[model samples]
Target: MRKQRDIIKQLTDRELNVQLIISQFSLVFLSIILSYILFDSFVDWLNYFKLSYYDIVYYGAASGLLIVIIDLVFMYIFPKKYYDDGGINQRIFRDRSVGGIFLLALLVAIAEELLFRGVIQTTFGYLVASIVFALIHFRYLKKPVLFVSILFVSFYIGYIFVLTENLLVTIMAHFIIDFTLGLVIRFQKRGANNE
Candidate 1:
């Protein structure tokens, strides 16, 4: 664990790193299925807990919007620099077409919404679950301020997920936040390397 963290730190930039490609695919499938396996109980818990529909909708929409706004700020502040070969514009738009961006995005949208928002979070409650979410990302990020910022955003997203009991809102929020940020971050790296 220490060694891996060290390697990750030395890296100039972060890209999607899969632990095991086949295993990750398998896990995504299995996790989604597992999430649905408990759907009935989850719904029952939601009602039993007496969560208001309005609360759910309001938090879900608000958090989603908040994350998007933050992401856009980051993008503008740190615009991505990408492949000069395809030209930065093409790298941002056209290059993605050649890859599995759409499919991967869809898969991530489904799996993450189901597993993170739908299942574990529902099972654990927001405050506790958000802590876990923050912890999961902790090792990759160590700066106190940055880590706290990310955690706050993650917790906010978790809060909305619990409030709404609607995966669509969380997934859309996560998708927009991640895609815009990830694209810019990636482009920034490529952009920087170009110079």
Candidate 2:
């Protein structure tokens, strides 16, 4: 954990953003490749993106807002140290504009949902997808609370996917959580700076 902290502290903001871009795009590419290998046809893969369930969008958005509220409550209740992730997340969003934050969050939500929920869960099962999702967030592994939180979040998103059977729903849910938190991080740092 100390090593991770030291390494992250050494990275420039550009380096972090570059790495995030590469990794997220890699996930998107992997989703495409995996879908190609797994599905019977392109059409079958396309079918996975069903957006006809308009009413479920509310459920997904509400789920996301609910999670964000719960997380904010947790942050208030817990020591700041418990929520720290080597300052990586702070570095990622603190300097970004609102538009930048929204774009980054959307990209992440889509890329992750495309691979984790759209491809992996659809192919294997919810449990497998959820486990894999948690594992990929390796930085959080050393932090017990963050690790457990990711597990809970992953499973919750997986449940949303299961209930809605729509990739867009999970993507929207993921985006809302990330975008809202990114804004919080952005303004929180600004407020700290002012203080």
Candidate 3:
């Protein structure tokens, strides 16, 4: 564990960003491959992209906002240490411009939802998919609070996907949550600097 933390501590922001990009795109590729193998046709995976504006607003965007609110409440209530994951998340967003952050968030949301919800959940059902989703967030494993938080969030997002049956809704929700939190990390740094 000590050696692992040491390795993580040595990673530069650029390296971390590159890793994030690679991981997300890899997931996207894996999703495509799995979908093709598991389903009848290559285009079948695209069915998950079906969009209903009403569901997007109600289930995706609204739930995203609610999760953000809940996160904020927890941030206020808990010690910052409980949320810490060796500062990897803050490093990923802190130095990025708003546009960069938005792009990163969008990429992550689409790629992850493509795999976790659109493919995995659709294949194996919600429980297995949600567990896999939460487990994939390996950085949070060392922090009990953050791990539990992610578990609950994964289940919540999976539930919404089940309800809407649209990947766009989950993608929107994921995008909003990640984008908002990225902004918070970025601005929080700026605010501290201005102090």
Candidate 4:
């Protein structure tokens, strides 16, 4: 653990960002390949993307708005217990432009949803998928509140996908949550620096 922490500490912001991007894309690619091998059909694993534009728009908007609201409520209730670790703050908000943050969040959302909801949830059901989702977020392990919150969010995302049979909804929700939180943290840090 000490060695791992030291390694993480040594990573520069740009290196960290690059690592994150690579990891997300790797997850996406690996999930697709594994899903095809196990299910023998990409369409079987990725059926959630088959929807009309109107349905996609409606479900995506609704899911995103709902998740944002829930996240805000949780943050309000336990401000200090949220993603208060300086590591996440630095990785997400510090030395990053707004567009870069949004793009990073978008990629992360797509990759995570594809692996967790698109393939895992479709195969293993919601409970197992949610658990796997929360487990992969190792940072949350040290923060109990954040861990529980993430578990709930994962479950909710799975539920939304199951209900609507549209991966776009969960992807949109995940993107909105990450993007909004990144912007909020970035501006808050900037404001603090200004003061």
What is the C-alpha local distance difference test score of each model? 0.55, 0.89, 0.90, 0.80
Cα deviation in Å at residue 7, candidate 3?
Answer: 3.1
**Cα miss at 37, model 3 (Å)?**
0.4
Taking all chains together, each candidate's TM-score versus the true structure is 0.60, 0.94, 0.94, 0.89
lDDT (10s digit) by residue, model 2, range 76-103: 9989999999887898899999999999
Candidate achieving higher lDDT, 1 or 2: 2
- What does the lDDT read for residue 146 in candidate 3? 91
Q: Name every residue pair that clashes in candidate 3.
A: none
- The list of candidate 3 runs beyond 4 A from truth reads 1-5
State the lDDT of candidate 4 residue by residue for 1-195, as single tens digits. 553446667888778778888999999998888788878687776666866666556666666667778777777888674655546655556667899889988999999998898888888899999999999887788888888878888888888887787888778878887888788778877888999
lDDT comparison, 2 vs 4, better candidate: 2
Query: For residue 6, what is the lDDT in candidate 3?
Result: 67
Determine which window of 10 residues in candidate 2 has minimal summed lDDT. 48-57
Error of 3 at 29 (Å): 0.7
Superior candidate under lDDT, 3 versus 4: 3
RMSD of each: 7.5, 1.7, 1.5, 2.0
Tens-place lDDT per residue, model 3, 49-119, is 77689999999999999999999899889999999888777777888999999999999999999999988
